[model samples]
Target chain A: MKLWTLTEGNKEFINETGSITKFANRFFIVGMKPRYEFKELLTQCYLIGYKSLPLVALTGFIMGLVLTMQLRPSLIVYGVESQLPEMVGISIVREVGPVITALIFAGKIGSSIGAELGSMKVTEQIDAMEVSGINPFKFLVATRIISTTLMLPILTVLADAIALFGSYIGVNINSVTSFSLFFTQVFQGLDLNDLLPAVIKTFFFGFAVGVVGCYKGFNSNKGTKGVGIAANSAVVLSSVLIFIIDLLAVQIADLMGLNY
Target chain B: MGNYAENNMRLGIFVLVGLIVLIFAFYMVGKNKSIFGGNFELKARFSNSNGLMKGSNVLYSGIQAGTVKSLKLINDTTIEATLLIDNEVKSFIRKNAIVTIGTEGLMGNKVIQITPFKGNSPLVKEGDLLESKKVASIDEMLQTLSRTNDNIAGISDGLRQTVVEINKSTLWKLLGDKAAANGIESTINQMHQASINANAFSKDLEMILSETKSGKGTAGLLLTDTAFATQLRMALVGIKSAGDHANELTLQLNQMASDLKKDLDNSNGFLNFLVKDSLMIKKLNATMDNIEKGTDGFNQNMEALKHNFLFRGYFKKLEKEKEKRKTIDQSLRIDK
Candidate 1:
């Protein structure tokens, strides 16, 4: 689809919208057969999990550091400087943890998924799979969906942890705080309302990444140039989807009376 | 393969450690939320809840003893809030304790505060109702402030009118005028003059008194000599006798006037002749008729005189004669 794909008439809307649902349904069908897709899932896990660790850590650490530095002075004005760790920790866990991790996932996992699939398309591997009677869609789409579904919440948890550590280090730059006290503050500031909604939204984020990456890669054309287009478009689309999904999640959570 | 395996092992350990730390932090936070711990329930009700909700802090002496577990509307006018508190802190809360709603920071969440009641013997029973203090709402404070502002406005209006009256009143202007100042100054000068005159009069009276003490004037002779006193007393008695005679003559004149008034009322008074004497009346009437004819003749002559210079000169001569006649009467009185 072009950038203005949604601006077209109902026929185009149906074609574009219909394909997403169609792919999601097929991915689910393939995902049910766990034994067949184990190796694929393992490989995806390694690529998404271990490979993405350093980037997520770096982003998470910086997120914690910057947030603490920005929030410290304001808390100090309120004579609440002691609660800085708790405040920063709550913010990171509830909001920054999921969003930053998902954005980074979109940038890293999304582009890689698009490039890999786009290259396979350009090389005629999809055609070869079709000729050999293997379901190429199932093989490619299921592994990504499973891996992303399992990975994003885990990544968010990891991100929230790393961000708090960074905040602790940041706090110690100007003031001393015990690790126990720091964690206490972090936990004390958080409740179910802060934690559950953030964790829940990451599933949508993972789904967006999986579906958009697979769609862009699976639909590649124009030989060598199409691979680059697919990779770039996948990152952009998934990033947009992450923000949109976050907005809807917040609205729904607000309606449900979840205070964050 | 050996080096690669070692690197993978270290990475796995690192990921495992990171996961453990993350879980530990989550558990700590969850425990603070009363998720992992066995907690007892406490409830505080306030008349003005002020936007307090579930999970708002329940504070005892500025320490967070628990969290608000839930809020339920009891009726149209009241809300029941259930709290989940750590079992350790529940003993300190008594049955007679009062709960009031207060704010955390200026812009922070509303918290339920329990104040210990020292006087009451009955302890707070579990699920028992505690008396709630009606924490004044911001609206109530604003209403009082508006009344104060209106009173201030009214006072300022009254003060402004008073000032305007002072500016415009004629009496106020009169007291302030430069001419009035001069009037006061002149009055003060006259008073000074009067005071000086009184002092001089007093000094003169004192001098006269001194002279009398020395027996130097007629007053002194009268005061100093006993014979002079007797003679003066005799002279005063003779003067009183003469005054009595004069008074008797005045009484006689009064009696005559009384008689005349009675006669007039009876038409037999000499004054009644003026009113009833026929010959006198005829003469007076003839004189009045003659005077009328003469006045008419005089008026005709005066009108002619206005046109005739000779007649005007004759009237001027007559006016000179009248003046001469009055002069003659004056001379005659002097000659007599």
Candidate 2:
């Protein structure tokens, strides 16, 4: 009620961490059993991945356009404006495309999952599903987690392509460049190291976002007021986790000598 | 059901497009790396590799023909480079082809450049070692440039020392220091002073010449006065006549001496008899003695007569005449 006292915040933090661990264990165990609700998983995949495309694409496009515009004056100082495609391509493929798309996914999907499940929990729908013996964790949580894990990589790849197209347009606003030459420069500057490591890390980002959302919503309390808190905390936690995961991915890539 | 079908279709389309993009990207990267192309491995041995890396582009005639496959140190001084050349361009790379390491741009990556041999050489077989030309590395070029700069600096130092020596000596001499014994300035200054003196002497000569033209001095009169010149000419003529007359008188005197000698030899003249005849010379001597005595006696008589009154008047008149004659003779000698 008073937000938190020191002792209460510490106690709540410990409880949340324990709940996340138990939820993660249940999510993996349920994810492994092959009694997947195909129709529900498909519907969730469509909702999580496809419904999020336009927002992801728009944000991806603007992100690339703004990045290129901001980078232009600095690169012009170095007289390397001709290398804009290569530089922008490498940056998007290795870092920007995946991270930004994942953050957007976290905001849109993470908040949605938390609020939807939180309201259902407040309405006693999760209890009803459990009483009916329908395995709500698998049907609700596992499908969403699996859908997010699968969809984010696909989304990232699409977002990266769209962002490069946006960067191309950004390049053309000031200078003329043939599309073939632009793409060639972009592809020439990228290696498997840039593409594979970035794509691989989005799986973890999707998992973290989904787990945080489900953990918040599945443990909702304090009635309708807790529903809003769950959604807010899901977005906040998933965003912070995205940066942390990105940092760890870079370190791992660096350790494996995959980064140049 | 219809909405679900539509969503599934959209998902399928999205996944398909994403896959195509990924496949295309991978294919482009693989093609550039020569992974998808049919390539043959060829090795070249070089003394220096010039920082050429494993994935560096291989070029033939300024076009991309292949990529470097691997590099190994063959020995301490040589590097063995394996190149994967595209099979399509392999036929053009003859057995005599030359490989050299070069750079992409001024600050770009290193590349391997192959020069295909001209006409009718056998094609290079797979794994055949091509001829390699060692290019100068940036470090080597910088070292040679630094050595050349050092040589130029040394030469400039020598020239500066020579210039400094010249300046020290010449400047000292200009300030009138005699210690700069070999200074050119001193000789130049002496020549300058001599020129100034010559200019003054010429001016003096010009003044003398102008005065002579105006008939001002002795030389001016000699040069300009005709009357004075004529008088000088007459005096010179008179001197010449006097010299001729004196020469004539000497001839006459010599003739007289010869005539007297002839008379002495003939013993016909009284002067000859007086000189040659002993008995006549004796009588002549006696007569001269008597005459001398008589003259002495006459001088005594004159002295005695000077004391007498009547003779004193006569002697005074004679003395007066003698004095007058003596004065006249002295005047004549002075005139001569």
RMSD of candidates 1 onward, in order: 17.3, 10.3
* Model 1: CAPRI class: incorrect
- Looking at model 2, residue A38 earns an lDDT score of 91
My TM-score estimates for the predictions, one after another, are 0.64, 0.70
Evaluated against the true structure, the overall lDDT of model 1 is: 0.82
Tens digit per residue, CA lDDT, model 1, B76-193:
7888888787766777878777888888766567888878878755655556666778888778999999999999999999999998998899978998999998999999999999
Kindly report which residue pairs in candidate 1 clash with one another.
A86-A185, A86-A186, A187-B29, B94-B124, B95-B123, B95-B124
Native interface contacts retained, candidate 2 = 0.61
B198-275: candidate 2 lDDT, tens digit per residue? 999999999999999999888999999999999999999999999999999999999998899888888778787777
User: Candidate 2 — number of clashing residue pairs?
Assistant: 0
lDDT of each: 0.82, 0.90
lDDT digits (tens) for residues A71-163 of candidate 1? 999988988887787688778977888999999999999999999999999999999998998777767877887777667777778888888
Write model 2 residue lDDT over A58-174, tens digit each, in one string. Answer: 998998888888888998998888889999999999999999999999999999999999999999999999999888899889988888888898899889999999999999989
Clashing pairs in 2: none
